[model samples]
Target: MANTIYFDEAGYTGNHLMDPDQRFFAYGSVVTSDEEAKEFVESLIRRYNIQNGELKGGKLVSHHKGRKAIDEILREFHGRLLVTVSDKKYTLACKLFEYIFEPSISDINSLFYGVGFHRFIANILYMEFMARGAGAEQIFDEFQDLMRRPDDGKLGALFSASKHPDNSPVITQIREFAQYRAADIKEEVESLAESSVGKWVLDVTNSSLHSLLAHWGTKYDVITAICDNSKPLQESGEFFKIMVGNEQRLKGGFAGNEHPMTFNLSGPLEFRDSKTCHGIQLADAVAGAAVHVLGGGTDDHAKRWRELLPEMSILNILPDKDELDLRLGTARRNVVLLNELHARAKNGQDLIEGMPLLIARLTHRLNLPPIPRPVG
Candidate 1:
């Protein structure tokens, strides 16, 4: 059966100097059985009052009140937020590497594949801990040993050193958490493995780019990442919109318009921009509001997805041109100019006249500074 894998990531500052341990990279995917996808579409239409005749720019109906009410409506429409699982051991280890080695962000990006592989290693360590009833510290040590001898098959040494008894309650709790986390992780991973189309979204906040490259690889049908447009700069607020655009193109299908996977990265504008706004809609808005009152994009919503699937697709339904232009003209214009300059800037020649002044004006107009650095 064909499936659509919507992915997004959370954590990991794009800045390389940032400690990886402080970052928590997450990827979440929602896989709909063919039948379920159809049902979801129908639910969306009915709940949002989406109609052929409905004007495209009208206020979309939502189940909740206030600014983010759409979150509530989406939850009421979609049933459950099925997710996949992955281990955080590698995520932790990567942070250790970053802390100890302190590689540039670009340098780490180059080792993307290795970073992802580390996460798998972490997953393996987690499993070992659960099976053998080990403490977090013991697990850490075993993980270190595995890093030294990645080829080893037998884990008898690690298991023998565990602190808890086979039937201890602590072991039970760890096992339960693992099982629960695994169910969610499996849902997301299986979607990627099974899908013939769709993209994966990732939250890069508190995460290393290496983590992503290792898991999914650098080459795919389409891979788009969303990052803070300008933090150290001036246009950070628009980062979310920029990421949405990239994800939209993937969702529309890149390549010969036939590729199966679409990858996305999202997060808070102030954070690493790895949290998927799309997944938030799915988990909290669509699933939470519809199935459980607890479902909605709150701190809990962010935390749940962050812990479960740190990477997932970020689906953004942009506002109409008129509204967007009115709200973000200067920032949008700068993005366009940045692209043009990137393509045409010869040698070290300045792309725009009075570049500093232009950026300052954009900052004044958009109320954010340090325009988003373009992805090469």
Candidate 2:
């Protein structure tokens, strides 16, 4: 029996920084056999009177009765949830520009950037961290202070100490963050002759897609992918082709290059209306619950979903402030970004505009940031 993954994302506002009310874009899936998905949908349509419009997390928030209906369906639906949500702030995408280019309150084109930026930063960090290993997990203060004095010959020593080699392009790539120290850094990045912020953003997205394809292709036998009709990667046949190639550039993340596998998909991924597909309907709820927890929600529903995630499926990609010295699991992704952030700060460089709260967060850390302490 072939397995299918019904995919949906919640709180996707183009770019996380673009949405004032929300700051995350979650890519979630409900995995089951093809026959199981169909049967569940049939049951949902008959049982909940679910219309063939569109099932959405926003709608599910107030649809407690609808939620109850979904819980009932899933008890017999037989599927597991798989999801990845990008916390844009921690993911290290530049959001400094949003401050300058804030669209009018009524501007319908406000959230145009989407989650591409978040993925871009995430994939970059994952790849770079893997190449450097323990070397990548530099003390934040050391890199932060080093960036302030780029002319110091210690740069050569630091590069020499890195496992990736001093002359490798990775050095240049990692150093770019702290290279700018004066003037309008936001405009500077936007006008960079080498790369526009847009190019960097797209590059990050492509890298992330490449890494994700690697992750998915190896982990599951995804026969059919029923994604939302509106997601950016929903109908991306060409995008997938270019990204999921057998190039040496793809692998990375916490797990490293051990499982550099290709796609085992049976056919082209399809997008469907969640309202019609009970799988996506439920996927949205799970994604919504995950986001709720990420955003510090403390409601009864949030508590319920928190209890639902199996430890294996609950991947925490963010860094634990207490354990910055150790590099393991998903925290490797954060280590890459934090190192770059510190590098940039030391060099007196400011990140590009539109970074959501990252600009403030970094500023606090670079200036006199608090070291996170465990409460007794």
Candidate 3:
């Protein structure tokens, strides 16, 4: 039977608003053989221990309950919970901006290359499956079936690099940076894309966003989420609302931009719309996708490897409780953070704290090669 896959993104804030230096974006696909999709879902329900129609015990709790609920759950559960934390790498990278080293395209590429390649491959696999004759209905059916299942031991995940393709000047700056350390960084990048560690890095960076999109995309057939860093929130929201509300405008204006196989849960959700859905859920989905890939399954899988991995144990250091209140106070909070980080660098102040700790934590979590300490 032909394989079918689902695609979605997590942690993408459209305009690098949340973390300027680290633009967190993830694209994940749930791929399964048409015949196996049903069985896969059935297996997931039992494995994740969903009972009475409620997800229980393990990472499933956080996923079903929402971010605030996750924080509560983590606080209560404490030891070795199966939860996926948001990008500690991004948080750490944001801290790197204060170190006075010029950032390069490779630096950004290294971060995202680790993030996007696996999911991109997953997408490629879907294309490969489609080329073999899987119909859209089969694909959508498998995707939905997988979603309904409880968290299996696997988490479906992947990551992608985010850049303003339209902004050539910034692109040029990145390219210039690449020219200087192309050889060393390129080798590292190549290694990362192929390695399991690289795969997890991508997962940590993008899984949250991917999960949300997968959840929402599977719910609506004509999904049309955009990743633009240019538009203002109010403007973007009004535009999306008008588009979603008026099918005619979408049919006429958004025709070419639409996906080929329209399903029930394929409409667009704006990354900038706070009221639309939970950002952390989206991030978790991306993590879920990564876990799926790491665990190895046809389409959907459980978080077996993720649960065992040391990285899974590291507590996600979110914006401080006080900071969270201030940050989430406005619709444009993400954008504000991005602008603040960019602005603060000019004055040489570290915009975010706890970065070094994050890096050390992640390196240990992912089992990355130890960062070489400078010989004193």
Candidate 4:
């Protein structure tokens, strides 16, 4: 039987990621049959003696006994669980880097993206802004405004922020890129303003669901995704099809090592109310638990939940401790380069000067040919 996957999210403040209240966003899923899903909810209610007609993960994780109930669900649930989490500030930084650094030329972009250059640069931008502390808000706000409505004034302010004299290498790199390569950024921003794609880029809920669907597609032959009534998923019938069916090309990998696959979506995505769907309720619990843990909740109840998460079968998108290690050649190093960039961001070191080294290491990770340096 085709698995029916239920989806829900927590800490979704739309594209306004600068909100201080919720610094993280999470999307969660529970995969199982219709009958298994219904029984799972019933069992939770019967076990916890839930009086409410529906389960709310937010309310459940706020108290001692409530948290225990959620813990039990995480441990004892029968269905498979998956979740993706993002730091809202970091996500905004990613959007900024994509706008500013992504190449416009298709052929060059393929090679850069193939080597994971875009992600590497985005991480650098994120770390640099993070090191700036309170000063980062203006840049973030200006970029946020620009994303909402493209304007020359907002664009100029953002570019000017990049030009600010900072000893940080990332900042210096930004200045160079903006002055020499900024025309492309301006053109791309203006182009995106004419479409809805720009706004959707920061929608963690939308992006997470798309990622989750792609991951699920790899494992299951056929899937019926049952999502909470999210406007994006509801209207994204064709978009979901493309994402799931592998219409979007995979990021290029080493030839012969590429393992291409496609998702078998049984039909159109089904949106339903949480009140009536036990599966969605379970998904809500999973997402809520993930956000609480990522948000650095300090109480014993929160701590207990944290200990349980590593044991659960979940796909976490958040960067972990290994990704923060300062060593470039750490055995744990991967495509993300989070470790190196973070160390540089903290010490205000220069990544621009290390471009050749970065390219070499990244290419090594993919076992690809040497990436040529740009000619002056």
- Please report, in order, the local distance difference test score of every candidate based on alpha carbons: 0.32, 0.46, 0.32, 0.66
Which digits, one per residue and each the tens of the lDDT, describe model 1 over residues 144-173? 443333334423343235355543543333
Residue 308 Cα positional deviation in candidate 3, in Å, after optimal superposition: 26
Greater-lDDT candidate between 3 and 4: 4
Runs in model 2 lying further than 4 Å from the true structure: 16-18, 33-35, 45-54, 70-79, 93-216, 219-222, 234-236, 242-261, 310-319, 323-376
**Which consecutive 10 residues in model 3 have the weakest lDDT in total?**
153-162
TM-score of each: 0.25, 0.52, 0.22, 0.76
- Best lDDT among the predictions, by candidate number: 4
Off by over 4 Å in 4: 46-52, 104-106, 114-116, 133-135, 151-153, 161-169, 243-261, 299-301, 307-376
Against the true structure, candidate 1 has what lDDT? 0.32
**lDDT score, residue 227, model 2?**
67
List per-candidate RMSD values in Å.
23.2, 15.5, 22.5, 6.6
**Where does candidate 3 stray beyond 4 Å?**
1-84, 87-172, 193-201, 205-376
lDDT of 2 by residue, 94-183 (tens): 232222122111141112122122333334443444354443434122332233233443433433343434433433444343233322
Task: Order the candidate numbers by lDDT, best to worst.
Answer: 4, 2, 1, 3
**Which regions of candidate 1 fall more than 4 Å away from where they truly are?**
1-117, 131-241, 244-282, 285-376
Clashes of 1: 85
